[model samples]
Target: MLLELKILFARQAEQQLLQTTRDFHSCKQEEGQLVSSYVLKMKGYIDNLERLGHPVTLGLVLGKIINELHAMLKLYEQTLPKNNAPALHVIRAVKVKKLNKHKKSQPQMAAMGQNHGKGKNREVYAPKPKIPPPPKREDPAKDSICHECGETEH
Candidate 1:
């Protein structure tokens, strides 16, 4: 009876280990997924696999993380540590620092890079035309030409 129980327990443990391994291998970061959350989920699987007597190495976890990370996190791919928590912290720190720096200068950089000639900076009004006033109408009786001669009367 004791031997049978040990065998059954061992088989159940083996099956659990296999399932955990599958979960770890199949885990991947979704589009726009948070890196911290993804890393934490993987770590949870690793912990479970460890509990089932399956060893999960730091390097293996790191490789899985690198494979599953989004393209935006690629910059830190070569530099991240092999361990889990520290790697998550460093990635978050780098991303936050980069975002803050970018936010401060993004508008100015955009304005400098784009052509504003026909954009929002374009002039809205054209110059007005200069026109002369009409001359005052002359009084015919007060300042008129003489009928007999081609001369003006005082």
Candidate 2:
């Protein structure tokens, strides 16, 4: 009975995965469809545009795309996911990840040097770093050293 349920779940998961891929493809197409329709309409306007040659047509088409993108951004801003906090959080997280890819990070560690900063080497499969070590003495036998002879007085 347990095996049957497991098989059933596996089948369902496979089906859902196939359906998810299908839906994702369809969603991409839907977004494209909106953009393409705008592009086609822009094409139509360009075709009939008079007293203007290739450059004007290209500019007009590009301007139309920009307008479409601006409008889409506005719509997205206004109708962002609100309820179903988990789904909204997931969506926002994905958006943040996507946005982060375009951003620059702080100064890289490689600039520090090979095995940089005295034993601060690259971690292979370790967890987070620990606390800083305590300060050490500059010269342990400073008191025993003679100032005149530059030797240990003891």
List, residue by residue over 42-127, the lDDT tens digit for candidate 1.
99999998888776889988877876664445645656665534546556666666665565444674678774446534333322
Whole-model lDDT per candidate: 0.72, 0.55
- RMSD after Cα superposition, model 1: 19.4
RMSD per candidate (Å) reads: 19.4, 24.0
Worst 10 residues of 1 by lDDT: 120-129
Clashing pairs in 2: none
lDDT of 2 by residue, 29-130 (tens): 235467777556555444433312323445655765677677787776667665434555556566766665666542565566543434423222322547
State the lDDT at 81 in candidate 1. 62
Q: Over 4 Å off in model 2, which ranges?
A: 1-38, 50-60, 84-89, 107-154
